[model samples]
Target: MNDKKSVLRSSFLINFAIGLLIFFAFTIGLTTKVYIGGGIELYGTFLLALLILALNSPYVKHLSILSKNQALVLILIAWVLINNAELGRGIYERLMFTLFFFLVYLFISEYNEWTGFCLNSIKVLGIVYAMLTVFFALNTGLYVNIVMPVFADYTSIYQQNYAFLNGYLCGFTPNAAINAIYILAALGVCFSNVIVSNRRKVTSWILPFFLLGILFMTGKRGHLIFCLIALVLVYFINSSEDIINKYSKFVLITFGLVIVFIIAVQYIPALANVFTKFENQTEMGRIDSGRFDIWNYAFGSFLKSPLWGHGWDSFKYLFEPVYGYQINVHNVYIQLLTDVGLLGAIPFYCFFIMSFKHVKKAFKFYKNSTDLKAKRDICFALYIQVFFLLYCLTGNPLYDATPLFLYIISCAIGEYYYSTRNKT
Candidate 1:
């Protein structure tokens, strides 16, 4: 048994290392500029690692039993991909996303091992990113034009405009929306650790504050709001009385500081002026900076084919005439509606809802669990799902690899826990 566990651990670490490298490659320009036959040919290393892990994983034989909802979700994904292929648009992209989702499900179905590794990995990466941001801020004095050329291309144009705010913490991919997702996911892991362990480690307290600071500095208002909501939900949804008692004071103090900061911003002239400029950058009424027009256009496109919808990647073509450039609708639900229509969306919605249902079951199971590690694992999984669900409202998480990877892994962890509970 020990030997088997060792093998599993080794495989997971190898796969995880490959995944991190792939993430950094895209972020830092290693593979971002690499293309073959006029198409970006990244993910070769990630796919190979995934293939190896799948081969070694005992769960491969039981893939069909991974979750009660897996089959239905798979069918829906197939339907969408088929429809996109029929339209001769976005077939490659949709197919890649489908494969990535399947692999995440397969790997994370190992439950305790793979899921724990993933959660820890997220926390570590978050801390590393936060520290890097601080280091860069101090070294460069938050200069706008002091970017590493290799990493600069991965950031969004809007982020580039306020590069001073981003600092050098972005590593490779510095888009504010994406950074927000990373920070929130990491924070969820750390929060779960505190709750599950029923003790507050120094890292637990420090890491969250560091991540929150990074999120605020990103100037991504939508993500910041999502993070706040997720944090509050995690705190209340956690059913551990001991954990609550231990950290309740900290939570209250944090809220108090936030309120005091707001009051100070209003009273201090220089601070108020800075705050006003920040607000202007993130304010929804800023036309080009706002998502309202993009959402409206996506809705109109959805209305065009309410039943079947336009195929995947159709929004760019549909909206370019009006917006004069191609971009996502900035809302996952609206994007799904525009891409797959109501028919395809029904199963898609069911897939996510069912995933959350498993998470809910895991939460209840852990509430009564005696094992501290198991309890913490489920809590972390639940928090990650909640964060993703809320973040998806204002971001195209479906199209982004990092966020999508974390979301599916959380679902798989929940499903795994739910299945284990039933077996006993």
Candidate 2:
């Protein structure tokens, strides 16, 4: 009945709600199969709404520090509306996910302490996933060792791949390529901020090793390229005492290349066997099918509804009558344009542009910020944002919940840091 008691009660509820969200997220991730048929709606959307309500309690008046990130929010709203209009649905229907996203955005932005907790939680999740891999290895006799677990619903493709590169290891996430890209993004963040390289050599070594593990497990070409880009940027930005640039970036990269060369030379027999399997053509056939059927059809459909998209989740339906292929475009940009038309895409572009601008400004502040910790955090945010921008070009950024969460958190953190700086 007391105000203090009420606030405490609200806090407990909020924490419980968030824990549930995280749990379901983990469950859905591990299950790897579509629960479909309203299962997602009941468990996912309802709990999300409850979580939002708990956070919006009057007891927690100044919930998020999102005032600083208002520009991004505005841009995103504008884009969603314009895009949805093109699809003949209002913004509300087309961008339903944005509704829940803003709630999450607010919770993280308004609550300062939760940010630290969330960061630590990610590391915890990584460790839990590592354990799951061991469990999978033990339960199933598929692989020689228990390094990663196979999802109950996932195909065999995930367990068969193991080729490391650039210090990334992808142990979980059913779609290895997508999982690798996500890990690489996580690595960029952890490397930039979580670990203080100067304070501990072990932290530095662990960061790269985990990254290597992720890259090897995923076997995704796009992720490999992105990791290389991240390495160059992280090295150059962090290398303060060295030459104008970090030659270590070049040298390390060359070393990786040389290692690949030597491995190729020494294991030509094994490599030949792998290459022989590669020649089977099924993989290329599937890719070619996607390129012609999904990609091309989506492009043509986008032109028809250039102003607004056909509808949210409506592209496959719209295309089925024409292309006879029931499939997602597998490209975020195209997905956006098809689902919400040109009007929507403009706002989407604005949201992205503004988010990057804020990140850039934060990076510039590093030069003037006297606080070493603040400088490091800002630069770290910049690296994470860079990873998002680069990864979206090749993959549908919002297809997975992780990327959406990453973008929202980045904006939230950037907003708080910038606002606090201006206040002083």
Candidate 3:
């Protein structure tokens, strides 16, 4: 009776955890006034309750107190040093956000291993959001001009007739481009696993169509280029034993078929005008123009505060806007250079490089492990983390909630795998 009850409790907790994670992933990035009248503290209130529970749990205490996260501790110290020095406002802004995200990771890992639920939830939410956004974007284009007033400068009262017909669309964050990238990264990791074979095959069939939908809907060149890069990397570097290797030829063939289908659709004269927009680069102007100017500004600021940084996230206000008001650098490497100087950033660089090397080794070590479950879990954790690191280059995934959850999962998995080896 006790054994059955224990199993039931575990199953319930896992299911509940998954539900909460899904809710967070789909809603965190949204700016909708879901919590009206400054009720945002509701989210905070729930988090505080979780924190209290975590503090009381011995398992949480053990996992949270790992030496592996020392690299992140250095990051916080660096932030304080720069902030105390009053070097530049940019450094201060960057540190504040980085520290906030860092704490989130620590808290989650310390609480328990939350990676499986968090990642699976993210994958599910991403697909749902992408489809919903596409559906609405198409309908909006048909009925009205789809005048995006929020981004008046970037988006005019343009007719989107072609957008409706082609099935490419998005919402406030734009047509699921970012979400697509996230899903692609998840798919890479999921497919790499030796387990989950049936689910992997289903995703393989669905994702190419999803990718095609994303490409057509958003008209975003960046994601298309990113997809191509990922494809090439997986093709050249993935081992035959890796899940991607098994499906590589099939994936490539599917992509070719998608291209042919797109061309066939373009035979319609109405769609020709829409496809022509692919050659246009007007939307990317702000990003391109700011690239050189931001670098020039960051370089001068960096020289003055070589040791620390201008202050986290303070790039624009403190540095004198070369182009416009400071926001985010949009590039992690550049952002790190300006936010945390070489003294601080080097530890992070070392941590990632070492972690990847370690994970790759762990995946190989799986073959020799006596315990099959432990071996598979270790491989799953390591490969998933690798996928996130690769995706981080394009977007600073580490700066947000989902990214923090992933790191926590990675740390917990690493600790469990290595400790078991030690015991044996």
Candidate 4:
């Protein structure tokens, strides 16, 4: 019931904390995966979250950081480690991620106002990300002509493959799906800035579509659709008819295209085939990318261990033997149920519910907020939260460090707003 003081100050130290996140995002493409002993992996973003939490923990010495119920998230993390059969680099990595994320959330939520700084960092990241996407997307030939010959030892067969460039634009990461999430987050922040601003800036209106183009080219069907849908919804939800009057026609045009896209992917054979090509590539003559069978098998695994679940990455062990290779389940919600079971999953998702609540509170409180700073920050926090939650349905952004870190920070800022709502 009591409000906690910010253990960390909003000066240079806070910038350092925010800077850690920026570093984590930029390095997603550069970092190699390494597993520590005991199935725990110390990753760039996860390490940054720990580092941020450690710096603030001592400052609040005896004070309890989490409200009573919020601490239950830690229990699910411990449960993952209880059964070694379910323990591995993936499982324990998630455990550590959950622990550090929540601990960091407690500390960082204290500085809700500092979120604008975080969004600024993301703006920088998004712009650079767009550049990287463009460069790499356009320069697949460069890697073949230069990188493959000079750095043959460094380039993997996958990277060396000339056809690799023909696929989605991955920017800095080897994975395009993860790259798309960052693009989505970047678009959310930049567009939020434009939407919530009291000033009239023409460039602000263009940056989001630019990012949208960047995301569209990634070949990530779910993220692209989700983004278009989000943009349309936010314009209506966050803007009044008169407020967005100038942009309404464009928004409606875009929304119409999005709806046509939805219809095309179902009723139109040519457009539907474009969307289903890769899905059918993995499974000849079949659509849904083989995800239907994966989800079914993974769900069956959950039935076997509904209480605690099979463990982190349980889907891999269950589906790999049948499928021959391991790919993510695609659906994070099913992955959670498959890996951790309903019991373990409840705690993991609790913070999402909480953070979203705070964002809703902030949105309500600041519905008429004129301050561009508050509006952008709150709107961005809300934007990415909704994206992340929904993307889990047919995508796995949470499995990657970059998007997870982005989502965690966005949500924490919302929590911050809720913590300070009454005071303001």
TM-scores of all predicted structures: 0.82, 0.72, 0.69, 0.80
The number of the candidate with the highest TM-score is 1
lDDT of 2 by residue, 21-99 (tens): 4444444345334444444553565456456544554325644334535645655555554434324533232245454
The candidate scoring highest on lDDT is 4
What's the lDDT for residue 77 in model 1?
57
- Alpha-carbon runs more than 4 Å astray in model 3: 1-22, 28-32, 37-46, 49-65, 70-101, 107-113, 141-168, 172-177, 181-204, 227-278, 282-289, 367-395, 400-424
lDDT of each structure? 0.66, 0.55, 0.50, 0.67
Model 3, global lDDT: 0.50
Cα lDDT tens digits, model 4, 1-424, are 1223343352456667667656655555443332223233345546765565556543254575665324554564466566434445534544455456656665676665457667777777777877777787668776456534543343455653632444556665555565677777788888887887777587766787677767766777778777766676666678666755747777687788688667754643333422544674656755576788888888888899998787666677787788798777889988888888888777767767877777888877877866667777878878887888888888776676666777777777776666667887
Task: Give candidate 4's whole-model lDDT.
Answer: 0.67
**lDDT tens per residue, model 3, 1-424:** 9999965665455446445544543454342333343334435534543454345444455653454554465465556554543343223322433343444444443333344555556556556655655555556753344334433343333423344344445444322444444445344344334342323454555654554454444554444455545444433343435666556866887689768767866652322322444444345555443555656666677777776766545555655445544345545556566766766566667667655665555555554555555554555556555555655554555555455445545655554454345455
Candidate 4, residue 380: Cα displacement in angstroms equals: 0.8
> Ten-residue segment with the worst summed lDDT in candidate 2?
161-170
lDDT of 2: 0.55
Candidate 1, 297: how far from true, in Å? 1.5
Name the regions of candidate 1 deviating beyond 4 angstroms: 1-30, 33-41, 62-66, 85-98, 141-148, 155-159, 163-172, 201-204, 242-251, 259-278, 281-284
Q: What is the lDDT of residue 225 in candidate 2?
A: 64
* Model 1, TM vs. native: 0.82
- Of candidate 3, the 10-residue stretch with the lowest lDDT total is 88-97
